[model samples]
Target: MPETPPRARALETDTIRRLPKVLLHDHLDGGVRPGTVLELSHEQGYAALPAEDVDALSAWFAQAADSGSLARYLETFAHTVGVTQTAAALTRVARECVLDLAADGVVYAEVRYAPEQHLEGGLSLDEVVRAVNQGLREGEEEMTALAGPDRGQAAPAGPIRVRAILTAMRHAARSREIAELAVRHREAEVCGFDIAGAEDGFPPTRHLAAFEFLRQENSHFTIHAGEAFGLPSIWEAVQLCGAERLGHGIRIVDDITVDGRPVTDDLASAIARSRTEPEAFALGPLAGYVRDRRIALEMCPSSNVQTGAAPSIEKHAITLLTQLMFRVTLNTDNRLMSATSMSREAQLLVDRAGWTWTDLRRVTVNAMKSAFLPFDERLRIIEDVLKPAYDD
Candidate 1:
C-alpha cells in the first residue's frame, strides 16, 4: 500500500469533522458518555464499574473492548447497559448519542439497541422504546435549535436526524416482539428492526418468524451478520432472513478470490490490483448477488479491527469492497467501546487506508441511500445536504 499523499496527510481533523456523514449501524448502549455512565451509576447505586474516575472508566472500556475477541469486546457493554436500566438513563444516553453525532457532523443516523436488555428497571419493552424515542426526538430538537436558522450554512454542526432501530438479542427469543415494537413505533422515531448478538451458533434463521412478520407488515430490517462469523452468516441474513442492509458485512470478502486464489495477505494490494486487473478477481455467487442487488454493507473500521473481523484499518475489507463497487457504507458501531465517531472512522480510512474525500463522500451517500428513511427524505439529504457538503 502506498503512503497517504502529503496533501491528504495535511488534511485537518476539523475539515474531516465538518464533513456531513450518514451512519447506519451505531449502537445506543454502546455509545454512552463516560461521564454520563459515572453519574448514572451513582444515581442508580450500581457499583460494578471497574473504574471510578471518568477518564479511567473511559480508558478501561476502550482497553477492554480492544481485546481482539468479539465476545470479549461485547463484555464491556455490561457497564453501559447496567446503568441504563431506567427511563431517564436511557433517554439521557439516547439524547447524548444524537448530539454527539451531530457535533461530529452526522447528518443522519439509525441508532439501534435491544429494548429487552433495558427492561431490568421494571420498564416494559414498549416503555423502553418510548423512552429512547423521546430522547432521540429531544436530541434532534436541541440540535436543530443549536444550529439556528442559518444552520448548515453558518454552523458546521448541523442538525442530525436520528431514528431508532429496535434490536432483538439473537441469543434471546424476543425477536418477534421487538419487530412488532419497531413497527408499532415506526411513526414515533423507530424506523426498523434488527437481530444482534453473537453471530456464531445462533443464525439469523432463528429469527425467521420475526423477519417474516416484519415483511408482512411492510417494515424494514437489517441483520447482524459477517462480523464475528463468516460468509454463511451473511448468506443466511441476505438469502434466508431478508436483511435490507448488513451490519458489519465485511466478511463478504471471503467470497471473493484474487488471482484465482483466496485473499490471504496484503488485502490492500490485492484490492488495488483487482481494480487495475479486473480479470484477476472473481466474485462467488453470493458476492455477485450482494453487489448486483446493491445490499448495503455497514462496515465499521475501528470496531471491525477491535473485534478481529479485520486485521487493521488500512487492510480492512471496506476499501476492497468499495473498490469492487459494492454498496459500502462506513460506520462507527460503538462510539464508546470503539472510542470512535463518524469523523474518526473517516479519518482512519483517509490516513491509514489512503481514502480520498471522494471515497468518504461516496460512502456517506451510500449510507444515506441505504438508511431506513422515507424515500423523499433520503433523496433530499443526498441532494441537498450530503452532496453539497462534499462538493464544497
Candidate 2:
C-alpha cells in the first residue's frame, strides 16, 4: 500500500489520500478492524468466522462484501457484532476506529452505533455509551498529542476529532426510546441520532413518534434514506420526518431528469455548471426543496455499490451533487465492510469523479459545515482547523 505524504496541499490522487476529510455516517461495529475481529472472536469463542489469520479474515470480508448480495455482505458483521457485546470490546473497537480514521487523514468523524446491539453482553445502554465515549476521548487526546504545535509553516493541524452518534435500527421497535437516549447524551459523546437498517422494506415514517419527539425537543437526527430504496424514502425522511441529513441519499437521483429521460446525466451536467456559475439549472420541486433546505447527503461510494444503490463508481451522484452545490460530504458508511478509508473514499472521487483540490476542500468543508455541533464549535473547527490546513 502507498503512504500519504505529510502536509499535502493540492488534490492529486495521492493528495486526496492525504487531504483532511470529515465523515458523518460511519458505523462503529461496521468499521472494526479485521484483526480485532479475529482476536475478539477467539476470546469470545464465536463460531461464525471462516478465517483465523487476520489477513485472511480481512480478505474474506472483502470478498463477501463484493459478492453483490446484501445478506452475504451483512454476514461479515456476525463476528464483529458477536465480539462487540462487552464494554471492553466496544471501547477498544471504537478507539481503534478513531485511530484508523486519523491515520487515513480524516480530520473529523462521527461514528454511529446502535447501543441496543451492544447490550447483549449484559451492559446497559448508558454503560455502552460511556465506554464508547471513553474510547473516543482517548483517541482524540492521543491524536492531539501526536499532532504537536503545528509543523511550523508547512502543516496546519492534526488528524481527527471524533464523536459518536447513537443509531436506532429501523427494524427494531425502540425508536422513541433510542431518540430519548440520544437526546440524553447530547453534551457527552452522543452528537446526534440516526435510524439505520435495510432501507427498502423499512422507511423513516415507521419511526414517526421518534422523529416527532426529536423535533419537539430540538434534538438533531439524520435518517437512512434513499439508499437501497428510492424517492419515497427520501420524501418520508425529509418532508415528513424532518431529517437533518440524509444518509446514503443516492436515490435522490430518481427525481432528476435529463433531456426528457429520467436519469442523472443532465443533472450531472447541470451540477458541473454550478461549480462555476451556481445558477445553471432550475431545480425541480424535490431538488429545489433539498437544496433550499440545505439537507446534507452522506454519500458513500463503495458502500453505495456494495449495497446496489449505485451501478458503478463513476455514475454515482456525488459528482453531480457536489457540482450542484448540494452540501455533499464524503463518508465511509462502513469502513470494514467496504474495505475503505476516508482518504481512499476521497481518492476514488478524485480519480473517477474529476474532483480538484478546490473540490476536495469544498466538499470536506461542506461536511464540516453540516456537522451536528453547536454553531460556535462548528465555526471554530472550520475557521480554526479546516481553513488554515487546506488554504495552503
lDDT of each: 0.89, 0.81
Instruction: Please report the candidate that would top lDDT against the real structure.
Output: 1
Error of 1 at 229 (Å): 0.9
- Clashing residue pairs, candidate 1? none
State residue 45's C-alpha deviation in candidate 2, in Å. Answer: 1.3
Q: Write the per-residue lDDT of candidate 2 for residues 299-323, one digit (tens) a residue.
A: 9999888867776677778877777
Off by over 4 Å in 1: 1-10, 149-155
Please write out the lDDT profile of model 1 over residues 51-158, one tens digit for every residue: 999999999999999999999998998999999999999989999998899989888999999999998889999999999998999999998888866665534557
Report the CA-based lDDT of candidate 2 relative to the real structure.
0.81
